[model samples]
Target: MSVSPTSQGQAAIFIPTPNYLFSASVNLGTPLAPIPLLEGGQRIVEPITGGTIGGPGFQATIEGGLAAPIVLNSGDGTKTQLAFIYAYGHAQDGSPFYLEESGIGGGPAQTTRIIMNVGGKFQALQKMYILAQPKVNEAKTLASVECYSVPTPV
Candidate 1:
């Protein structure tokens, strides 16, 4: 017996493949303390030659292998300017893991937040990437990540 051309089993079947999805949602609000302005350290919305604010910097990490344009959401406080630096390291596969530098050969996209003040709930986005660094002879991975922004003049 032959299946009919118009039958559900033989209607010139066309199975479409699933498309690739790239993107992630990261929660950055984890009660972060003010990053102290240190000597010789670059900060957001502040000149590199200015004195340190003498506070603690915002620190957090994200899951590696996230597609470009990672969304960083933090419900804490507000300020001006933000920076996300991707630390280079090795992956579990022993392959070098690195996030392309901003503006480097079509590097990963980035988005900055314009916080108004500090001491309250706030949210922001960080599109940059933080390379994955798997521990030697270990399965866990780590990446040193930090966020910075300046408060509006009172």
Candidate 2:
């Protein structure tokens, strides 16, 4: 008789915890009307007016951006959201950064992937994988996203 170990199929470079990066509070403008697409898909485009972002050693103002989401029925009396967002911001010390994100979810716990190109002290984020949890208020006027840096094994 022999015993064999089973695997959960996770990658070898998987890191359980991620480092805290920053949190962004975004103010939104009124969204444009939803345009109907084929196969019951609806496209909604919104504008990001302004906001703020702060973290351990960085603070910045969110200048502007766009949010375009395509929604489709899930056939279970629910809908699914696929969001694509972009933001351009600058820090207090004149450092500029750009952020792009994509997520799929209709609930508050959205698992988002973030990519940021920043200068100044936060330049280390250039090679790191970023993940975020974003939450938007019911009024759709404000959004708060908590970002983290994922460290992988070499």
Q: Estimate each model's TM-score.
A: 0.21, 0.86
Give the top-scoring candidate (TM-score). Answer: 2
lDDT of each: 0.25, 0.84
Model 2: residue 32 alpha-carbon error in angstroms: 0.2
TM-score, model 2 to reference:
0.86
- Candidate 2 lDDT, 29-141, residue by residue in tens: 99999989977889999999999999973589999999887888877878878878999989877889898999888755678898888888778777788888888899999
Give candidate 1's error at residue 25 in angstroms: 1.6
Q: Model 1: residues >4 Å from true position, as ranges? A: 1-21, 38-79, 85-154
